[model samples]
Target chain A: MTSNSPVGQDFWDELRRTTQARIGLGRTGTALPTRRVLELAGAHAAARDAVHIPLDVERLAAQVREIGIGEPVLATSRASSRDEYLRRPDLGRQPAPGTDIPESGADIGLVLADGLSPTALDRHGAALLAELVSWLRDRYTLAPPIIATQARVGLGDHLGAAARVRTLLVIIGERPGLSVSDSLGIYLTHLPRPGRTDADRNCISNIHPPDGLGYARAAQVAAGLVEGARALGRSGVDLKDRSRTEALGPPSGSEPGIQPGHSPRRR
Target chain B: MIHRQQVSGVTYAFDGLVEVMAKATPLRSGDQLAGCAAESDGERAAAGWVLADLPLEVFLNEEIVPYDTDEVTRLIIDGHDRSAFSAISHLTVGGLRDWLMEMAAHDHGAEHLAAVAPGLTPEMVAAVSKIMRNQDLIAVSAAVQVTTAFRTTIGTHGTLATRLQPNHPTDDPRGIAAAVLDGLLLGCGDAVIGINPATDSPQATADLLHLLDAIRTRYDIPAQSCVLSHITTTLGLVEAGAPVDLVFQSIAGTEGANAAFGVNLQLLREGNEAVRSLGRGTVGDNVMYLETGQGSALSSGTHLGVGGAPVDQQTLETRAYAVARDLRPLLVNTVVGFIGPEYLYDGKQIIRAGLEDHFCGKLLGLPMGVDVCYTNHAEADQNDMDSLLTLLAAARVPFVIAVPGADDVMLGYQSLSFHDVLTTRRTLGLRPAPEFDAWLRRVGIVDDAGRLTPFDPTTSPLRSLASAVAP
Candidate 1:
C-alpha cells in the first residue's frame, strides 16, 4: 500500500480497543480487507442462526427455580411455531388458548420470554432474573415466574393481567444484532393489561454480560424503575430512570427541575 | 368512485378508494397483516386495473383517510398547489405513470418532474407507484432531483451522501467517537453525523449533542450533526443553547400516529423554526432530519382509513413525505427493512419498498434517503442489504445511513457499513456532497482522485479527536 493515508496506526489501534465497533480495518480499493469481510459474514450468519435457536425452557425454568424466588410456570404464546412468531407479531402478544395462568394478585409479575433471540434467553435469562430477584424479594411480593415461548414483549401484559400483578417486568431476548446475539432487554409496565402500548412500558435494553449492561447494574436500574412505577402509579414516559443520577451523585450546580430525591412525575 | 373491475371473467369489487388503493398495493406482509391486501393475485390485478383508470383528480376529491379527522389529509389538501396541478391535472393514474416514464427518458424531464411535484398528493404518487415496476420506480426517481443543505449540500446530481450513524450502546462518548472516526476515514458523514441516543432523556441527548459538536468543530468537518431524540427533547436542548444542527424525529402519516410519537405538526413546526433560528449551518439552513418507516402507523394502531379499513403501509408511508416536505427538512429517510418481517417480510419486499419510498419521496420533491437495513429475525442478511444498497445507489438516492461494520449495536439492526457506502459510490462513479468531497482532500484523508491514502495513525490529523474522546 502507498504511504498516502493520514491515520496513525497507534491512535487508530487505541481507539478501536475502546469500542466493539469495527474500525481501522485497512481497505482494499473501497472494499473491506478479506479477513474483515469474512468476519462480518460470519457474525451476520451467527446472529441470524441465533434467532432460530429454541430456548431450553425446561433447563431455564430449572435454573430460575434454583433462584428460590417462586415456582416457574411454562407457557406459550398464540404463535405455535418460530416462523409464525416472526411473521405474526400480534399472535406472539396473545397467550395460547387455555394457558391456565393463575391470577395470584402478586405485587410484581416476572415473565421470561424467548423473544426474537431465544439464544439470549437461554444464555442470560436465569442469571438476570436471579439478580433482579435479589433486589426485589425483600421489599415486594413476587409471583411465579412465567417462562413463555414464541413470545414478544407484549405477551407480558396479558400474562401480567392474568396474574393480577401491580407491576409486570418482562425480561425478553432482544433482536439479535450482528455483534451481540445474546443481549437481553427488560420492559416494566405498571398495571399491565391486554391493550397496554409501548408508551405504557419502560424499557431497559442491551442487557448482556461482559460487554453490554451487566446483570447487577441492569437489576439495580430495573429495581429503581419498579420503585418509581410503584410510587407514581404508572410507568413508561411518566417514569424516568434516575438511578444513574443517584449513583453519580447530584449535579454540582442547582439546576431547575433537578429534584434530588423526588418521586417520578408526568412529562 | 368506480371501485370494481373484471379480470379473467372474475369480478372484484372494492368498497372505496382506500380499499382500492390498499388492495392495489404490491404484495407486502404489512398490508396482509393489516387485513387490506387483495385476497389473490387476480384480485390484486383487478384493483390495479381500477386504480389505473382512476383520474389523478379523484385523489383530490376523495379522502382516503377522512380530511376532517386526519391532520395529514388536511395538510395534503391545504397545501395543494393549484397552479402546479394544472399542468398534469387531466391525467389519470395510468396516464401519470406513462407521463413519468416519458419524462424520465428526456433530458429536461427532471425539471418537469420537479415542477409537478407540488401538484401531486401522496395518494396520487402512491397510486402511480402501485402500477409501476421496480425499474420504473428507479427510472423516475433517478430523473427527479431534490437537494438540501446544511454544512454540505445533499441530493445534488452525481453525488451520494451518507449519514454516519455512530451509535453507542450506552451513549458513551468514547465509543461514539471511535465509530465517528471510523466513518470519517471511510468518506462517510457527508449527509450528517447523526446519533440515535440509547436514552431519550434530555440530559443524555444534550451530552451527545455536545460530543458531536466538539468533534465537528475541532475537525472542521463539512457535515452536520444530529442527536436523534424526540422532537420535544431536542427542542428543549435547543432552548438550552446546545449545538443543535438538525432536529430529528420519527414521523408517521396520520395525526394519531404522530400523537403516539408525542408530536404534532405544530410541535414539528416549532422544532424546525428553533433549529433554523440557531443559524448553525455553514452552507445552508435546511436543518431537520426526519425518519419514516412503512409499518409505524400500523405498529401504533393508527393505520385506520375511510370506513375504518386499514390503509396499506406503503400509501401511509408516502404520506409521511408530505410531513417532511412541509418542514423543508435537510434529509428524509425511510428505514425500509428496519421494522422487520412483520411489515416487509423478506429481501424482495424490502427492496421493493425501498424503491417505492425513494420514488414517492423524490416525486413529492423531498430529498430522500434510505436506511437499507434489516433485523436478524427478518430472514435477511448482508446479501439482502447489498441488493437494496446497490438498487438505491442506482436510483441515485440522496443518502443512506452507514454504521460501523453494518451493525447498529444500540438499535439492533444491520445497515450499510462504511465499506458498503464506499463500494457503492465507487461502483456508480459517485462522490460525496461537494463540500465534504473537498474537505476530504483538504484533510489528506483521500487524494484528489477521491482514493483512500494509507497513513500512520500516530501522525494523523484526526489524532487530536481520537485523543480528546479516548477513555
Candidate 2:
C-alpha cells in the first residue's frame, strides 16, 4: 500500500522523526571502532588457509593428547542449501541425529564449533582456548577436549548431556559484521541436556584478537555458572536468579532491618 | 657482496646478497651440478616454476642473476614454479585492490599503474572501467553467496538467533502475540481492541471462551469495547454451538462484552458454506477484514496476501481511500465503534508513508486537533509510546493504545510517565480496561490488587510490548 494510508504515513513520519532525534542526540560517541570485525575477517581468511593446507590429522591428534584430553567425540552437518540457511532460521537449529548428545554429566565438556562466523575460529581460537584452559585448570578438573566441528551454540546442551558433565562450555565463532566478521562467542551451561532453552545458557561474546573478551575471563564466568548451577540445581533462568541474588545481596528480605516482600515500611 | 659464476660461453656475475640467484647458479651451470645431472640422466629435474624470458631489470636485493633461457623453459615445462601468477589471475577488482596495495609497497611501476588507472586516456580507461565493473559485480555476487552460505550453515544446525524462539512458559507468548497484533494496532488504539472472536466449532468456541475467561480473570479487562480477531478458521454459528450473541450475553456484565473476533475470510470462504452463511446476518460489530487485491487502489506487491497488489506509499493511500469508502457503510449501519482494514503485514511501508494524505487526515480528522486513533495492540514502554506519540504528533492526531494484558497496561502507564519526563508533557495516553486486566491475571502479571512488576526493564515483559510497535 502507499504511504498515504493512515498507518503507513504515520509510521514513516514517526520513524523519520525518531531517527533524526537519535542522530541529533549523538549518544554513542560516534560509534566506537569495532576491532572484532577486522579480527573476524582475518580469522576467516586463516581458516580458509588451514583448510587448504595439508592438515596433519595425526599432528592435531598429538596436540589433543598433549593437552591431556581423553578420547573426544566429533560431529558435522551441512545446511540444506546456502540460501535456505540465510533466509530461514527455523531450519538452522535442527541438529542431525547423531550430532546431539543424549545426556551431560562431565565436569566440563569443551566443544569447538564453526558458528555463523567460521573465520572467528582462525583469529581468536588459539588465544581463547589457551585462556580458557589455563583458567579452567585453576578451578575444576577438565575432561577430554571435545572438539565439535560445524556446531551451533545449542549443540553444547547435547554434548554436555552426552559427556554426562556437570557443565558444558562451547566456544564457537560468532556471525561476522561489516566491520568485525571474526568474533568468538562462548556459551556455558550447567547440567546440560537436550531441550535446554536459551535462558538456560549464558554467553560471553566478542572474543577476538586484541582487546576482546579473553579466555581467562570467559573461564571465570563459566566456572561461576557451573558452581552456581550445582548449588541451584538448574541453569538459565534459575541460574540467573541465583547469581543476581548473590550479586545484589538477597533482595533485602533476610536482613533484620527489613520485613519481607514489602517496600520498607514508610516512616 | 658480489660473486661470479661462469657457465658455457657466458660469465654471469651474481651478488652473494641474492639468495635465489646463488641457489639457482650452482644447480644449473656449476661443475658439481654437471656431474650430478649426468649421473641422474635427466631422470630427476630441478623444482620450481622458471621464468623463460626474465626481464633484465628485475632485481633481488640489489643483486643481478643470470638465467639460461633454454634451461628455464625446461624447468617451466617440468611444472616447477614459485610465482603466484595463478593467484593474481583469480583476483577480481576487489582482489586487485589488495594485490595492487601489496605490489605498490615495493614496486613504483605497480604504484603508477594503480594511480593512473582511475583516470587514464579514453581507450585505456574504458578497458580498465570494464574490468572494474565486472569485478564489482563479481564481488557483489560473492558477498550475496557468502551471506547465503552463512545463513544456511546456521539454519541446518538449528542455531538461528534465539529471539525467534517460541515465547511461552519461560518465553513470553504475549510478546509474540503483540508482534502479530502490533501490525493491526499501528494508528488506532481507542477505536479497536482485538478479541479472540471464534464462532467456528464447539471446541473453537470453548477455546475462545477460555481465552476470554483468561483475559478477564488474569488482567481485569472490560469486555464491551474490544473486538476479536482470529488467525484460525471461524467456528460454525449454530444454536447448540456458541453463538456470538449468546457468548456476548454470557459474559455481558464482565469485560466480555467489549471483545470481537478477527475473521480470516480467505479460510472461511473455503469452509463449509454454512460458515459463510453465518456471515450474512452474523456480521455486526465484528469487522470484515480483507487485504487488498490486484487492480485495487493500493498496489504494492510487498504485502503477503493482497493478491499481489502493490502496497507502497501511493497504493497505501489509494487503499485508505477505498477502505474509507467501502467500510463507511458497514460501520455506519452497524453502529460499530470503529472500522479498520484487515491486518497489515510487516514492512508494508504504507501506514508510515501515507499519514499526510487528506484521505487519512480527513477520515481520522477529529475536533480539537485530536483524532480518536486506536492502536490495536501496543507494548507498554517509553520507546514504543514515544514512537506512537511521535507518529501521532506528526499527523497531529492524539491517540490511545490497546494493551492486551495487565503487564502491558502497567508498562503503558509507565511509558506515559516516561513520555512526560522526556517530552516535557504526556502527549500519548493509555486506555486499559477490565478486559486487559483479565489478560493480566491470566499471564500472572497482576495480583489481587491489580498491580504488576517486571524484573528487568531492558528485557522486561514491558519491552516485549515495545517490540510490537517497532518500525
Candidate 3:
C-alpha cells in the first residue's frame, strides 16, 4: 500500500508493531550506561589517538622483511581491472609470476588484504596482527610473520601453499558500516593451496573498536582453530565439529535412541 | 506351625503358634513387595545402571524400533520431489527458457534434440514427456513471474538482475526480466535505473523485452502495470540534456583492479555531471546497487589495486566506509548488495565475516544510507531462511528473496513464507495479521481503489484480505 499508512493498519504493520513492542518490552530498563560514558569521554579524541604512531605500509613491510622474516610474496590477480575481477574469480586465485616465497616452510603465513573494507585495515590491522603474533608465539614456535600485500582471500591459499605453513591466517579489513564498519576479519586455513574451497577455512570477524570481536579473543580462537586444524586436518565444519564435541560430551551411544513420530524431529 | 481346614470348596490355613507370633511379627503383603521391585527397576533405568541380568540385545533391538516406513517413504518421496523439483525448477526458469530458444530452432529444424535426449526419438511419447517437463517448468515459472510481477506492480521492487544464479555461474534471464519489471515499477511515472545488455545488441534488448512481455501476459499481470518502452541506462543520461536529478552508485568493486567503481564513478561524476548537475541523495533514501561492489572486496582486492598493500585495518575500513558514505547520500529508495560472494568470503562465515561483517556492518555503517539492503545470491539449497530472517530481524529491516533460475521462485516464495511465519511469530510473539501492511510498504504495494492508498496493515483494505490468509 501507500507509504503514508500508519503502523498496525495492515498485516505488515501489525507484524512490525508486534516486533517493535516485543523488542521494546523485552529490553526495557536493561540499557547499559557504561558505553555512553565511554563514548562521551572518547568523543573529542582522534580516531587514531589509540595508536602511538601512524602505520607506514612500506616501512612495515621492510621491517617485517628485515626482522629475518620469511620472503614476502606479492599477490596479484589476472583480472587486472575491476570488471574482470567481478566477473572472473578464477583469475583472482592465482598469484603474479616472480614473487618470492621462502624455500623452507614457515611457521605461519601472514597475509594482509583489503578485503571488503580497505580503510578499515588502517585502523585495526596492527592491533589484530600484534595480538595474533603474540598469541601464536605463546602457543608455537612462530616463524616471522610474512605480510603479503594486495591480497585476496584466495591469495592466502596460494601464499600458504608457497610458504608451506601449517596454518595461513589473513587479517583483512571488513567493509565499513555506519556504526563500526572498520572491523577486521581473520581467515585461516590448514594446508592451504590454490583451489581450496571455503569449507577449508575458518574466520574470526568483526575485530574493531567497539561492539566487535576483540583481538585477544580472536587470537585465542584463531590459535585454537590452528591447533584443532592440526589435529582434525581441516577447518570450517571439521574444526567446528571437533570443537563442539570437545566442549560437550561425545555421543553416548551409536544410536541416540531417537525414535520415529517424535516431536523433536517434527519441530 | 500351620494347620489346614476345608470349608465347602475353599481351603484355609492357620498357624498353631499364632498367639505366640502375634507379639513378635509384622504383617507383609505380596502386592507391596512387587511394587518395591518395580520401583527399584525404574531407579536403575533412570540412573543408567544396567543390570547384568538384562540382555544387551533387548536394549539394542527390542527396546528400540528405529524403522518408520511411513516416515521413510515420506522422506524419500519428499527428497526425490525436492531434488527433481529443484532441477526441474532450474530448468524451467533458466534452462527451460534457454530450451525454448532451442525448441523454436527445432521447430524451425535448425538443430536436433536426439543428442540431448538420446533414447527419445521424435515420437509422440518423447514429445509428450518433453511437453510435460515444459509444462512443469511453466507452472513454476508462472508462479515466480506472477509473484515478482505483483510485487513490481505494487512498487516495492529492487535490483533483480544483479543476483547470483543457483545452478549456473551467471544471471538468469527470467530472473533479470522479473527484476527489470520490478525496477520499472519502482520507477513508475518517473525515470529509474536500467541495465544495458552487456552485449549492446538491439536485437537482444528487443528479444528480452519480448520475452518479458510474453511472461507478463502469460501470468496475466494487470494492465495498469505496463512495461516501459525503453530499457533505461546510465549512458542514456549523457545523450539526454535532461540528466536525472541524481545518480547513486555502489562502491563495491572499488578495492580491486577488476571492479568498475573507478570507471563508473569517473563516468557518473565527470561525464554525467558535465552533461547535467545532479545532487546526491542521503544514505537511507538512496537507491543503487553498491553491495556487490563492496562485498567483492572480501575475496578480491579493491578495483584500484590498493587492497594488497600493508594498509592498516582502520585505513581499509575508512576507505570502504568512505565509498559507502559517498554513495549513501546518493541512494534512492532501493539499495541492493550481494550476500553470496561479495559480502561473504565464504558460505560458512555468515555470522562473523559474511552477514555480520560485510552486509550488515557496511550497510549500517553508511551514514543514513540504504532504506533496504538487498541480499542477492543467497544459499537457496540450505535453510538460510533463518539466518536471513535473523539478520533482518536484528537489523529491523525488510528484504527480498533472490533465487537463481526463474522456475525456483515458488520454492523461494515457499521458503520465505515459511520463514516469515516462523520468525515473525517467534520474534514478535504475536498472531498473524489479516494483512502484512508493513511488508507491503516495504515492497511498495498500494491500493488504487482507495485513492492510491498505501496499504498499511494497521489500517488498509488489504488488511482484511491478509487476515483471511493468515494461518
lDDT of each: 0.87, 0.32, 0.35
TM-score (all chains, Cα) for each model: 0.91, 0.30, 0.35
Q: Which candidate leads in TM-score?
A: 1
Across B229-348, the per-residue lDDT of candidate 1 in tens digits comes to 888998988889888999999898999899988999999999999989989887889999999999999988999988788999999999999998999999999999988799998999
Give the alpha carbon lDDT tens digit for every residue of A63-156 in model 1: 9999997789999999999888888899999999999899889899999999988898998999999999999999999999999999988889
CAPRI class of candidate 3? incorrect
lDDT of 3 by residue, A198-231 (tens): 6667766667755566777777777877888888
User: What stretches of model 3 exceed 4 Å from their correct place?
Assistant: A1-56, A59-74, A81-83, A174-180, A241-267, B1-448, B451-471
Scanning candidate 3 chain A in windows of ten residues, the lowest lDDT window is A258-267
lDDT of 3 by residue, B214-279 (tens): 433443332211111122333353244322323334333233322423433334334333322333
- Please say which candidate is ahead in lDDT: 1 or 2: 1
Candidate 2 structure quality by residue, lDDT tens digits, A194-250: 777666776666676564555665656666667777777776655642223345553
DockQ value for model 3: 0.03
Judge candidate 1 against the unseen true structure and give its global Cα lDDT, from 0 to 1: 0.87
Per-prediction DockQ: 0.39, 0.02, 0.03
Question: Ranking under DockQ, best-scoring first?
Answer: 1, 3, 2
* Alpha carbon lDDT at B247, candidate 2: 14
